[model samples]
Target: MSDTILTLTGVQADIAQYHILQGVDLAVPRGAVTMLLGRNGVGKTTTLRTIMGHLVARQGVIGFDGMDITARATSARARLGIGYVPENMGIFSDLTVEENMVLAAVSGRLLAERRDRIFAAFPPLRTFWTSDAGTLSGGQKQMLSIARAMAEDRKLYLIDEPTKGLAPAIISTMVAALRELKDGGASILLVEQNFAVARALGDHAAVMDDGRIVWSGEMSELADDAGLQERLMGLSMEGK
Candidate 1:
């Protein structure tokens, strides 16, 4: 098998009349986390969406596990072991936490082993097991979103902004859970704006600029070089 679990070459997409993802080239290595970092409006989310087939690519190829999935439906992609936790959380407001998990599991049941794993990682999920997802706090919702994606086994996870507006303590929880997921041999393509979380979880780093990946390297290398981070991620990325 190829070392890369996911690869995008010259991938381009359009949102209505506006063009995004001019030519995004990225690779998520096997059993590692690849951080997708960039300034706002730079098409980082678009890249992940395109990969999941939520947005069709206008050009280029998307390869996953040695298969070309560019024309595959979103559901087909999910069935192929690609989990997705989109930016909006994508949970039903009226659904209880248990119901949400049940729906995400695809098997219509959350198996004992997976349930235990998720509960151990995020204790709050168990605490509010029967509560409506809408009643939970933002951090809890985010946790549920992640757990939903992991409800079943998956080779690759496409996660967008897992810590966009979370507090320090909750972010730490997210960091820990993601670390566990990464350690458990899952290849992740993560869109995270929080540098600390990205640095902690990412094995590799890819930076997008103006709808294209401008830099790709080891996460440690990017963490150690402030100049490179500034040039690729922008001034707002300073001290982040």
Candidate 2:
């Protein structure tokens, strides 16, 4: 069995005239979280978006579960068990929480066990199941976003900035939920700004700069070295 669930090799992408993702390479190990960390505008989100097929890569290949999916449409990628929780959270404000989850399910049905698992991780989703998603607080919306993706038995998850603007308590909850998700043996490629949260959930770390991966190794190695953190993620380059 392959240890890697996803691989990006020499990937390049462009947005209009703006060139992004210049020769990016990444590998996400199966059943572990790999944190993609970098400064703002460093193409971390672009990397995830490229992997999710939200952006067409102008060059190179994207492989998922031993198959090349570079030319696959976004929906096809999703159906292949690669769940994406974008940076924006991608909530449907007008839709009820149940409706939003139903849409995220993709199978057109939320199975009992899946629903139970989602609720166990995010209780707020159950609280406002019939309510409009916009009525929920920011933390609740983030929880819903994660719950929706996690509702299915996915082989890999690409989560971008899951805790960007959350309160500490909510972040703690988010961390706990993600830890539980990791414990369940799921592969995740996470883009997190909070180093603490990244350290907590990531088993491996990939640091990006100038649109390419500059470092890749165990998360603990990065977390344990403050000097290295300062060198790679300098004072001015610490977040998204």
Candidate 3:
């Protein structure tokens, strides 16, 4: 088996007349949390969508677990052990939290043991099991989306903007949850704008600019270099 769980080589995609991903090349090593960091409109989210097959790639290759999945449908990709938690949190507002969990359970990807593990990781979810997802706060909804993804017995996850619009306390909770998932051997590709959160949870960091990766290396290196952080990510830690 390959050491990398997911690989994207020279991937390119377009949305109607707009070309989004331009020769995007990335790799997710097995059992690592890799953060995709970029400024707004830099195609970070597009790259995640392309990998999920939500937006078909016009060129390049996407491989999962040693299989070329560039042409596969989104559902096929999911069944192949790729889970996606989109930026919007993609939860059904009308459904109760339990119903949402049940819906993901029906995917049949998760074993009972896996379900228990996920619930254990997010105790807040257990408290709101019967509440309608829409009625829950933003943080709770984000938790539900992540819980649903975990319900799948997937090897890789593409999580986009997980802390967007969340309060600092909620963001901290999300970071803790991701760290727990990583400790449990889950490989995650996290798209994050929050540098602090990324530093807290990511092992590897990739910086994207104008639809291409400008820099990538160990998260520790990226975290300590304030000049690079300011230049590539427009982040400064002096205030923090």
Candidate 4:
């Protein structure tokens, strides 16, 4: 197998007449957590959507596991082991947590062992199995979204804004859970606004500005460069 789990070369996408991504290039190494960081409205979420096939790429190549998936539909992409957790968490509000898990597991054809593993990794989800997904706390909902993806035995994940609107304690728990997923050899493409959370969990970092990737390198390098952070992320020591 190739070391690269996902690759995007000069990708361009548009939502209606508005072009969102212009020549965006990215790569997620196998079993690594690659973060996409930028200020709001920088097309970070759009890029993730393009990769998931929710928005088709008008140009460039999107290859997963060495196969070109640019034209594949969202369902086809999912069957290829690409899991997506959008910013909204994408859980069914009316469904119980257990029902949601069942739907994901059955749809993904996941084995019982994988289901057990997901529950083990996220005990809160197991605890709230009988509760409605919409009724759960923000952190619990995020956990459920991630757990559903894991239950699918996906090799690659597109996780957008995992910590948005979450409390500090809950954010910490989410970060720990992501770290655990990374350690278990799941390749992740994470879109995050929280630099602290990204620094704690990401192995590689890419900065997006005005619909293009401006900089990408080791996560530690971006964390240490305050100037870069301010210029690209609109973040400073005093906070945005």
In order of appearance, the predictions have TM-scores of: 0.96, 0.96, 0.93, 0.92
Model 4: per-residue Cα lDDT over 54-73, one tens digit each: 99899999999989999999
Q: Estimate the Cα RMSD of every predicted model relative to the unseen true structure.
A: 1.6, 2.2, 2.1, 2.3
What TM value does model 4 have?
Answer: 0.92
Residue 48, model 4, lDDT: 94
Q: Quick one: best lDDT, which candidate?
A: 1
* lDDT agreement with native, every candidate: 0.92, 0.90, 0.87, 0.86
What digit string (tens of lDDT, one per residue) describes model 2 on residues 124-239? 88788899999999999999999888878889999999999999999998999999989999999999999889888989999999899999999988888777787887853234
Q: Runs in model 4 with CA error above 4 Å?
A: 106-112, 237-240
Backbone Cα, N, C clashes tallied per candidate: 0, 0, 0, 0
Residue 138 CA displacement from its true place in model 1, Å: 0.9
lDDT of 4: 0.86
Candidate 1 differs from the real structure by a C-alpha RMSD in angstroms, to one decimal, of 1.6
Supply the TM-score for candidate 3: 0.93
| Cα-lDDT of candidate 2 | 0.90
